[model samples]
Target: MDKFIDLHVHSTASDGTCTPAELVKLAHKTGLLAIALTDHDSVDGIEEALMAADRFQLELIPGTEFSTEYHGKEIHVVGLYIDYKNKALTDQLRQFRDFRDHRNEKMVLRLQEEGFSITYNDLLKTFPDCVLTRAHIARYLSDTKQVSSISEVFDKYIGDGCRCYVDRPKVTPMDAVSLIHQAGGTAFLAHPCLYKMNRRELTAMLDELAGAGLDGIEAVYSCNQGSDEKDFKALAEHYHMIISGGSDFHGTNKPYIKLGTGKGNLKIPYRILENIKTYHQKEK
Candidate 1:
């Protein structure tokens, strides 16, 4: 492909180390045609990204990764080409931030009770741009030497069902898709393989999401196995959905993953996005 785009990326607005401006500069220097700032549960960075994208002459897709749930398991729904200023989407994101803040407070308290020195305010100050995720908290813990690494923090405390883990109020995947569509964005399932569900379970979730007007799936990802792209593409074809791809870049958080080219070998052609626009236009 002559050009490439990374449809999923994070900024310090949510769990990533790079600021929005820095991410845009890096994408430009790395020779990417475009990148989507799909920060976790937040679009606070989109404005800065847009400004920098303009200066660098690169496309910046304003997006967010919505945290949703199905049968109590957390699922991420990515919204691409979003209008971050849309009141409905911003209002809902505010609500999500509030819920997550409550959950983060509870989590911090639980950790403090277990003799950790971390506090909720520390996390807020540390991750000032947007809503704080466990990834942010993990970095705090890791930086403090309470944990050797972020991975260790999750393994011992905040991974799902861990003692320090607290569940946020659940937003269904279907509801997420609706909100994305309401905001005039395309909704996609992000990194399905990471969900670790069997084919039957995955299909059922897709069916559920499709019923709510989900437009596509993240068929290509930074961590795809040798055959994963082929398998995921076939799955998307089965559901008549467009295929999206990304590096899921988290800056230093996932240091090995790169923008546009994920984990060194993942390449997402510009046409994938063209295809998305084409598919949605026909639907309209």
Candidate 2:
């Protein structure tokens, strides 16, 4: 495999199996040049990742993956090269965590009422330090014979319109992009193809996001097919946006996905790192 950097990864601070420091070590062993611990909606892992980066002499980019809403569908925006210590970002994450806790409680109740009999306690035990997500619940169900696998759990129980599916409050896409920019970060759409939008719809969304101050898009993703990658690359160029890529690593929750890299199906341009270096050089 060609040497590369992974821009999207997670740690136990959110939903990944590895800790932040462990993730950095894994990146080093895997021969990655640089990596970003873009945990979901939190920067708690950044400090630890930073420590590991220093020890291993690896370049670490502080980042986060935020969840937002657009047209009633979930939109994930990735903020790279961020100031993890920014107070406003931390405060907003606090609010998001609070909401997530409540949402998890509701989901547990719904699952119990639907004859699953799984308690919130069981989920918490499985994810003591990490945020409780539907993914965690799915894992629990799969482990206990309630479901065959994580994907099956989502498909039959907790997925959209499934027995335990519930809507939670989400930040608006515009607001999310603005927050990242305000924190001195570049905001990009993560896995735009996963939204399953058609060409016209994708174009419309890209336009709207550009207007909202989005700076880039994930042109290379782990699960993106060859045609999808081409389309996203073209889209990024058409919008004059930065092209980024990542494996969307989640440790055990997604054992198939690895740390600090995507699957063998991507070609992340090295220019993305050069662009970021240039931007920071100019700022300095």
Candidate 3:
């Protein structure tokens, strides 16, 4: 069997439903040789994941997914093989968590103003000990039958440009790239297709990020079509950036995306991890 690796995943330390230990067990059961816990704006799960990796003899890369913005669109940047103990990185992530907490509170207030009977306290009760994300809010709305589906909640509220949407503070793309470098990691644009940018626009953005120290682009992703993967691979080649991929697994928070195989057809080779490490070594 071909060894596989999932470079983007999440655990309960963030919005994902699985704990770090549980995720590790799942990875082992799923036959993943390596997996990175690239939780949103937090490395709190890294130590626990590291312990689990050691126990299972699985490769675990310490990573984080940063929330960034450009042209008012939310862009995500993933930092792979980061030094999770780096003080500057940890301090900034702590600030991000604080901002997320405040943003969640604001969203709750906005929902209440829109005549929804929800509160930040209710969210905490619903998703105890995990980051209060829009996904959590959507789940609450769906579970209560206030929304027919999770997508419906985003369409009617909470999503960007929706009535109850409260934008979270974001770092610039350049700043996000720099933070990854400061943490001794490779920065890659996460899921370029999700930006909803056309070909020329996305290329322009990638050119800017490439100049800002971006090392790769996510050419293979759970949500990407085959044509999108081909286009992204071409873009990566055009910019001389490494190609990277991931399942972007968030456990039950994103039920369709599996750990190693996303949507049942995704297969990211272990060589992608080796390629990244090879580049990191050369950068040193």
Candidate 4:
């Protein structure tokens, strides 16, 4: 009954449970008008997702979530409607994968040092043919009885400031925006409220990013509170940035919120898609 567009979802190519094709089918069944596979640091799902889109008549946006550093914090930049075949984009993502692999290895070593016996090979077995992520590591911990739940893994080891946390290489926000632009996409700030910054800090960060050619912001997201969503929508309007929203689905890796749930309160206006369409047309 609801016509929606879920712009920030993952598949097996990243940390989600479904394959690209299966996820597309699910979206069609759920009445999503369009869907973007904004997998973290990878566009591996784009090709299959596009094919599935053709089958289901769903609009597909090639997307990836890149990690960027700003003011000592990690922020995510989601590039939408990208040319996945762009050599520059592919090359940069490959480099990011390499960095991620290195970080995963370091995380395993850190966990080992903390007396957890998980190995990289053991972790790889969990998601063959998919990008490895912290979610995968957390799942491994939970599955093997190393931890009781994924949240435990995060609280004890993988979360920010945890004992086994390892920093990965990140691009500056400016460079990330530039890369997304070069790849023929618009860079949007993903899940701004997750940064947990106060009003002054969040506004300052948004202003800084908007000045750096950031084209949009996630005005609605799963984790945002009512006030937070209203504030972000106002910010988007004031700054003339396109509004973006998503379910932030990660399969069973997240238990409470399912795909397209949007924390049960978020609704993205169809006008956002019209805005994106208009912007693309003008670029042509």
Candidate 5:
């Protein structure tokens, strides 16, 4: 049997629908040899996932998906095999996390100003202990019948400079690379094609990130359109960087993506992780 793994995944510690233990249980059930819990802006789910993976004897990489800025767009950087317990890692993460809390608060106020019946208190009441990313806000709006759908909420209101959107303080890609490396982990740009960059623009960004000790590229993804995977793989080779892949599963929040086999055609071979381990060893 060929072993497969998901390098990117999410749980309720961020915006995902499933809890940490549930993600591990689901990954084990789906026959995945490993899965990295790269929850957005949070590593809170990793502990429970680690315990669950231990029960199943599966490998769960403690990882995080941090949002960084480039020019004006939001860029996500994924850190894999991180020492999640490292004080330097946790402290910096916590410091930046307060920005998210403030952003959410301001967004709710902006939405209310636009005559939407939302508030920070109501948001917390509905989703206690959940990181209130834009996804959660969109869901709250849709569930309250304020928006026809989650997509509608973004289209009309809070989709990055829409009427109610709020930007966090800038954390550049270089900053992200430094943080991940400080935590003794490998950093990869997640879903590069989705950044809406032309080849020239994308390559330029990759060059900039590479200089900051970026270790790899997420060359395979569930949502990759034609030739995207091939092009990304070529870039990784051209840059002498490692390659990684994942489904970017969010459970019901992103119901179309499946673990291990994403969108019915995605399969990440275990050799990718083997290569990552080899590179990580050499670098250390």
Candidate 6:
């Protein structure tokens, strides 16, 4: 009877299909002791999630997943135990949302050029309040039968290097770590293995990020293989960084990943959250 937690998750506040309240209910039903609503580039859902947490009698951690770039590659930094009301954090994320709106317009235009007959207005009508993302575009394509599947939309049009792809404005990894700290949170590299870098390169990047106040690395992730876990653990130990993990669940948006358990075999012990809290206390 070990308590489990999901440190990374998204709701309709971002690209995820679940609303904050629904996500909280699902976490309780799934028997997770706690869950962090780390929506991409936004904390808009945190307040709603917090209310749901109280109603459901579950622990909720206020967090965000900040998008960043390093050497032109997209990197994600997870900010745990953040002050969601922090003005600096909100302002910065608002700037990013503005950039995202502009980028979405460009993407829609690119798709229209390809004779897709879709418009940004159409996406707005479908997802009125949710943040627009490539996933939304993919969903639009899939729903209209323009693509056979969501994966096809990515593979054929909107994925990185695809014809309709457009890069959003992002901060440097150092700046991202700094922003997390500014919001009174610890920054952890999200899913390092997903970067697909060689061991040496990855080590160097982690070393640099550690120097920039990166507090942890996601050593136990839903998609991680046994070898990946071992490697990430070693890296965390070597860098004297805290270890973290999560399911990265997105509900129906990513149907394969589950809430606390990922792929039906993943189990993240509660000790990880305890360790993170311990580190936060020590930092204070």
Candidate 4 minimal-lDDT segment of 10 residues: 261-270
Worst 10 contiguous positions by lDDT, candidate 2? 260-269
Error of 6 at 119 (Å): 1.2
Give the winner by lDDT: 3 or 6: 6
lDDT of 2 at 80: 89
lDDT of 1 by residue, 1-284 (tens): 49988999999888889999999999999999989999988999999999999999998888999988998678999998878999999999999889988999999999999899998889878777666889988889988898789899899999999999998786899999998988889999999989888889999999988889999999999888777789889989988889999999998888898777878988889999889878767765
Clashes of each: 0, 1, 0, 0, 0, 0
Give the per-residue lDDT digits (tens) of candidate 6, residues 257-277. 999987888788899999999
Writing each residue's lDDT as its tens digit, candidate 4 over 141-162 gives 8888977899999988999888
Superior candidate under lDDT, 2 versus 6: 6
Candidate 3 per-residue lDDT over residues 2-64, each given as its tens digit? 999999899988879899999999999999999999999999889999999999999999999
How well does candidate 3 score on lDDT at residue 140? 90
lDDT of 3: 0.90
How much lDDT does candidate 6 score? 0.91
Q: Looking at candidate 3, what is the lDDT of residue 263?
A: 95
lDDT score, candidate 5, position 1:
81
For TM-score, the strongest prediction is 6
Candidate 2 similarity to native, TM-score = 0.94
Query: Is candidate 1 or 4 superior in lDDT?
Result: 1
RMSD of each: 1.3, 1.8, 1.4, 1.5, 1.1, 0.9
TM-score of structure candidate 1: 0.96
Full-model lDDT for every candidate: 0.89, 0.84, 0.90, 0.86, 0.90, 0.91
Best by lDDT: 6
Q: What TM-score fits each model?
A: 0.96, 0.94, 0.96, 0.95, 0.97, 0.98
Q: RMSD, model 3, all Cα superposed? A: 1.4
lDDT tens digits by residue: candidate 5, 190-233: 99878999999998998999999889999999989999999999
Model 3 stretches astray by more than 4 angstroms: none
Q: Give the residue spans of candidate 6 off by over 4 A.
A: none
| Cα error of candidate 4 at position 177, Å | 1.0
